[model samples]
Target: MSTQGLERQTRNYLSNNVPQIQQHGGNFEIREVDEEAGQVTVAIGGACSGCGIAPMTMKAIEHRLPESVDGVSEVKVVRAGGPRAAVMPSKIDEMDEMEEYEDYDPPF
Candidate 1:
């Protein structure tokens, strides 16, 4: 498939698959899609950035994304801003400040 075709496909895949990922509390963004080399780099973000299970989130994206794009050889992640990840949260420890709980009775 053409590179443009691949990019479109990749974008679509991300849009579609992201909700499934979010349901599990993982969030990510696509940083680069290299159709020539058949590689995709994703940046982990949101709660995923500080979660202890970040690797699991990365692996989940790596495993599923490639299969969606045509001619994808592999998924190359740059993490959230580390040597690998890009644009990582500046203060991972401060994430607790984001939590706000609302009690609700189940409709079911």
Candidate 2:
């Protein structure tokens, strides 16, 4: 298959697999797909951010992505809430302002 084809397939694979990842505790975003280098940069957010199992999650991606989608040789996960995760935030995180909700002190 062509590079473009591989990129498209990989993109779809990432999108489709997001739901499954979310079930694990967090979400994933495809930051970039390099067909030639056979690598994908994904931003992991929510509970998965600082979770210790995050590496296992990444390992699963690194192993399965290439097998499921051609041209994907590696999966790079960028944490979105961990110490390192602070460097990269998913689009959702970027759009959300947690501070706005902090003002709501509901007294039941």
Displacement of the residue 68 alpha carbon in candidate 1, Å: 2.5
Model 1: per-residue Cα lDDT at residue 19: 65
Candidate 2 deviant stretches above 4 angstroms: 1-8, 15-20, 82-108
Candidate 2: lDDT of 20? 49
Model 2 Cα displacement at 104 (Å)? 41
> lDDT per residue, candidate 2, 1-108, as tens digits?
676687678668766764545675667767777777888787777766645455555656666778898677887766665553423455434433344433332211
Candidates in order have lDDT scores of 0.60, 0.62
Q: Which ten contiguous residues of candidate 1 have the minimum total lDDT?
A: 99-108
Give the clashing pairs for model 1: 78-84, 78-85, 79-84, 79-85, 80-85, 80-86, 80-88, 81-85, 81-86
